[model samples]
Target: MKYLSDQMLIEVYHRAVDLQLDSAFIELLRSELDHREIRIAQVSA
Candidate 1:
């Protein structure tokens, strides 16, 4: 996650949502976003 750029993270997040991935996995992405202090306007997972 540290190696991924912010844009990459955002892309992965969108993909996760689109795929309807597991909630726990999505939560990890959300956690990374929080760690980076990035705020997403909304999340539908």
Candidate 2:
């Protein structure tokens, strides 16, 4: 679960940069990435 979410976050991040996604969509992705990062940190810690 963690790995998949992390991979998705990376993919979305790249897509946001490479494709120049809409600001709202990018913000949504950023929020998702933030949540995923927190989850990953908790799991690792």
Candidate 3:
């Protein structure tokens, strides 16, 4: 699960950087990533 989460984060980061998403969209993606990380931590705990 941790590995998958890390992979997802990397993908999101790449998309944000490579695609040059607008600030608003990037912020939204960051929010989603934060939520995913929280969920993963909860599940792991």
By TM-score, the best candidate is: 1
Model 3, 1-45: lDDT tens per residue? 245565677576557656777777766656666867633222110
Over 4 Å off, model 3:
1-13, 38-45
Q: What clash pairs does model 2 have?
A: none
Task: For candidate 1, write residues 1-45 as lDDT tens digits.
Answer: 999999999899989988999989888998999999999878665
Q: Candidate 2, residues 1-45: lDDT per residue as tens digits?
A: 355557777676666666777777766766777876633322110
How large is the C-alpha RMSD of every model relative to the true structure?
Answer: 0.9, 8.2, 9.3
Measured with C-alpha atoms, the lDDT of residue 20 in candidate 3 is: 77
The residue-level lDDT of candidate 2 at 25 comes to: 78
The window of 10 residues in a row where model 1 has the poorest summed lDDT is 36-45
How should the candidates be ordered by TM-score, best one leading?
1, 2, 3
Error of 2 at 37 (Å): 1.5
Better of 2 and 3 by TM-score: 2
What is the alpha-carbon lDDT of model 2 when measured against the actual structure?
A: 0.61
Q: Kindly report which residue stretches of model 2 are placed more than 4 angstroms away from their true locations once superposed.
A: 1-4, 38-45
